[model samples]
Target chain A: MDDPRPTSGPVPPRRPSGRLEESKGPLVEPSAGASASGPHEQPGLGHLLANCEGQELQPGLHAALEVCRPNTADLDDPALAEVQAALAADAGLRRRLASLQQFDQALVAALRDVRAPAGLEDRLLKAVSALAHSEGVEPLVEVEAALLAPSSDAASASCVPPASAEADHAACRDEAGYTSVRSGCLAPDTVLPSKRRAMRLSSRPMVLAASLVLVVGAGLVIWQYRRPASLPTPQQLANEATGQFQQDLSEGDGMPASKKWPAQVPASFPQLRLPQGTKWRTCRLVNVSAVMFDVTQAGVKGALYVVRAREVARGAQVPNTPSRVVFTQGVSRTMWRQGDYLCVLIVEGDEQALRRLLRPVPPVT
Target chain B: MVQDKPQDGIAELVARYHRELFAYAYRLTGRAADAEDLTQQTFLAACAAYHSLRDARCARGWLYAILRSQYLKQFSRARRLVINEDPTELEQIPEELPYEPDFDQELLQQALDRLPAEFKVVVLMFYFEGCSYKEIAEQLKLPPGTVMSRLARAKQRLRDALLHTGQPAFNGSMEAGVPQVVREGTPHVGG
Candidate 1:
């Protein structure tokens, strides 16, 4: 077969200074006084002449040189078919590729020694086990049992009317193995089936009336004394949002695409750049009208919540710059309003770390 | 087969990818303890959120994304702010260096550590993880062009570091002068 490769070109003379100059063409001359023993050096100019045979094979050579070995698919690319063909036909190009491959192999080999510490796998397994235990799906029986359990508070007990004797008997018999409460009206040892049933039926209405008044009185007292369900604080809201976002990600819903704030919104939100090593995980529309961005750094998790000023509670004060709000142990919330969005960042760390995580937002011009 | 059971699936994932994830974590954090923690957290988070993983094929990238995210969340506060080198200065690096096949692993690590985070990540994902430019770009949420440029620049810096290994100018910790650079710039946060 006729050799499709370009014919070998003349070699440039070796520099006398013993320093190699950058070669403009594929025909490179060995530096003067270069060690003959080195693997990269060729024996003579004949080898150099053998390598570069075409009009400016330098581009192809350079392109082939830039290709990483793992990107092997690129070698087959039609756009690089000429380069690939040349590489196959030319011994010198083949040698250079081989040398680069060797370099990559050596680099990989060097890095291969940095393995995970012993027992890391075990520790990780334990963590997974712990997580499983915490988040495992509850069995139906356990869920049902929890639902059936009577209120422990004495006040609540007064509010709950006693079950009918026959109903209690059926429940006790059916759930004998698991039932914690039998209706208080029936004793387990009572054997007078019909006669006791008649007496229980006769006393049921009076007992029910007395129970109703006690329930009503207890309800009134409890209602008067009970504290109103307080609204979730901003910190709590942030925590909930983070949890939901993670849940969404894990469930394969993926993150919602980030959209710019609506034009009608009056406030300018800070375009805070995340610190190095931190990445944008996902942005979600949350709380009906807010945007939540969940970000993670070095195993630490944080979330940024952006809500409109109108959406925020009336008289709610959000700082214009990052300010630390310690919500609970091991978590901190940072809140600031920029533009129309009340931005809050909830992170799992101390206040100092939270402050560091919340880089100062540049003013919107 | 284990994928049918969530716990078993997580265990399988941990068993398979822990070492690779840990190695990447070590490269990113440059500390064994932090790397271990990052790996552990990734798996735990995976376990907790595995229910949401709709595609089994995406498990590897998802794990990696989690690990990277966790690393960022944990260490963002501690990261030393670095002024990126001017593109012109980076372009001045020699295109090629004399091939030295016998370099120490520690020396290579030191060189890798000296690279900026963005560049280092691309290099690690490309060379060590065998990720293609597109894969790396997807993982890091960067444009493929940016990933390629970063990889190219990183390789040049590594070559330079390797060629100049014995000099004190490049030796010692690259982190020592970081505080000064950080002090010079106002920290801005957004992503």
Candidate 2:
């Protein structure tokens, strides 16, 4: 994929002109009475300056001290003691340490001042909400219902005020009310008010049970009667999957090379085998649960998507078949069935690289 | 329902760390738009993997790890990517700093912008994030000595830029050229 965004700003690169020490005129001049004798005798960093005697400060020793000064609290090296000694003996060294600390404070302040863009939190919430809605809205709805459902065990209810559990259930009821009010603080777009109302109405045990049965029955009926006609075409499935892959690539950013494939992926699914190490995460494409693997090989990147063969459109072809490749939007894509799993490979290169990426396709079990 | 919802935890996490994380991302990416994108991606990844977070206290570090990971993946192969492996090939540091060492933050950032990603990550995690050398070493999977080495080298460059030169002074090539497409995120589907 090509990057339209600039990695950095318009700052022109500058060449460092002089040596670090030369830019600064000089170190602290030694005190008239100071001597390089010892800390107990001299009592200030001026004694160390007396040692420098106008020659360049020892870079090796100074470099070692630089590492210790900022991290004195965390470091346990014997060198830390030397840094401490230098600090204790020289008021100059102590002042330098203080300056570094102050600089650190300023750094944290400056960086922290780079606040998140306005509405970032709102955007994040909406993105997560959309993902949750597609992956499964029922779970969130059920959670809302469970929160509102009255409990006979009020005394044992987790939300009951610690002071006492009311036999009248008023405390538990009030707590639940507070909980609902708090949930209302979610972003405006997170959960619709009408949906919350529906969930609340279904909080009754009988109502919830009936709704569950009806939902299951309706789902089965759709699968039996409506799905065959509704299945998307091979092209449609590929386009949708590709769109999703691109969206994920754009939004998901990049995967860490060391990140392991999520263990949550069920064992029943086929494992992705690519010459390049891959990281897998669960995703929804074409309304079906699938695993998306972020693949990279020889510095080229691509995505390999695996989903159940039964889930893609009939035109996707059930059962094993030869991989078919096509090019779209300057990328190469291919789809084929291996056992019960359907695989789609997308990359920016020619058919050879795309095929190369999917090499040694594990003998279909 | 009886307990705090997972979303609640995520909301709290976002509220606490989003700004800090965005700043870190900005420093890493050297651009606001890319930083915003990286921050959003970090949170999305965080939400997806929220369950793996065993301790709430570790969320800050965990989120940072994710952001850095995303940054590396996105830019590791970019033309500007560079790593100075010789830790001992030291840049000269000022013998003494002004009592305050105060300088323009943008200049400091510009200096930071000049560093290779490897050195840049270390410097930010240490100074900006206030991560201990140990914490940085553990997070980046490098030896503590290496962390100190990178931090020391980076600090010298920054100190030179901020205190001595009064402007950014590091030398590096600009991006060779923009990719034809956002190479990292490209995907296509064809019949």
Candidate 3:
């Protein structure tokens, strides 16, 4: 059979191209753009060959070796074998290969030692400083610090610093929104947004159905927080089990009959002395068990419920449950001039009226 | 994006990536002056597009992208300006050197420098960076198969170049009187 293309039998080693770059081939570029006399004017060192074991080595001769030799992973293993054999055929190829190896070694060393050039670190720092100055990017330090520390409900005893522009800014911002200064004097502002967010939050009720599950979760978190979670000593375990005896008194089926809850309830609290016009009175307080206490607060004749804490946790998913208000002794709901506060209206009748009258005050410091 | 603030702070990224970007731009434009212009243009582009960058860690890639666009824009303008002019771009070569490199290396460099702008970067990236065919493809946005074929062909051109020259000493060898190839009938030993 005859073929149009030429035959091959240890043909002279040929370097297909001298380019080390991935750009389109440079052969035509030399002829049309650079070489005045043209490509064929001088013969090329196309290939080097050596025969051994009926297999001939054919090492190519060109700068193309820069890209193909040394570091190039041998993808075409057989072809590379031929290349290596052919390379050995020429004493010059062997020498050049050695030189190329050195070059490669140097390159590897350089790459390994890559550094932000001389003064690069300083320059980078300077850039950061300049960007900070120009952009006024707030350092996240304060936010991060606040996140790490437990929120303190106790009032600060330290003297307040003189108000600066930041303080003035806060004051201006306080008045800028729908925030009201008087009790029941202002309409509710747009506090929340779009229907989508509300819908997403509605999925939690399914998870909260089992009182046992909630109680166990609360107990585990308390155990972990109040004490290190290292393996408890036998004595410690016995002590804990003994301490929980009073709580076990309210046991009811799979669900503990106790009324323990997790994650503090969000209650509208005194932003500023819960407007003086508001009245406050003790509703009631009673221990349902060692672990659970129930309390209700009654607002003074005119006041609204306003309780304040230093921090609040964002709400998350929980199970749905029926809401029932119980009239009890010692818990007092305070009255406020504005905004929603927690209201748990319990069982009605004479017990409810008496519960409002018996509401207890928050313990004084 | 450019909220009013002190101007001196941001001058750091300028100092850090600026000079290196200039060198990269030089390689890109094949001329020093245009490289400098590209460098300055990159900083401006960085300033203009700073807000769009979400990850500060990506600043290098982002800067490179900006430089690339700047190169393309400038290159187009250059093509338009040079349309009727046969301006020799040889001045892009450095004027002097402390020690003369070998003539072969010089010839190779000359041949490489003379290549069209498109081919030069491919060669630089391949040889200097030792990028893989796939990596080259990704950087140049070309197919990998094309990269392999192009590299093979590039080697062939070099082979032809060295073989055609025919000067034993000049044809990729410097030791005089030393034959590069083993002749068929050579003395096997020191008998």
Residue A136 lDDT, candidate 2, scale 0-100: 50
- Per-residue lDDT for A284 in model 2? 70
Alpha carbon deviation, residue A342, candidate 1 (Å): 40
Q: Write the per-residue lDDT of candidate 3 for residues B63-147, one digit (tens) a residue.
A: 5545654564446334322111221111211121101012232223334334444444454445433444444555555565555
Instruction: Name the candidate that leads on TM-score.
Output: 2
After superposing candidate 3 on the true structure, give the runs of residues whose Cα lies further than 4 Å from its correct spot: A1-365, B1-10, B52-62, B76-109, B128-130, B152-191
Q: Which one wins on lDDT? A: 2
Instruction: Give the per-residue lDDT digits (tens) of candidate 2, residues B1-191.
Output: 21145566667767667766767787787766667666766665565555555556456655666677667656544536454554442224333333222234356666778887777878887666566655556556567667777887787777666655633221221112311112122121110
Ranked candidates, highest DockQ first: 2, 1, 3
**CA lDDT, candidate 1, residue A228:** 26
lDDT of 2 at B140: 61
TM-score of chain A of 1: 0.28
Tell me the deviation in Å of residue A300 in model 3: 97
- Model 2: reference contacts kept, as a fraction: 0.14
Distance from true location, Cα of A351 in model 2, Å: 52
Predictions ranked by TM-score, top down? 2, 1, 3
lDDT of each candidate versus the true structure:
0.49, 0.51, 0.32
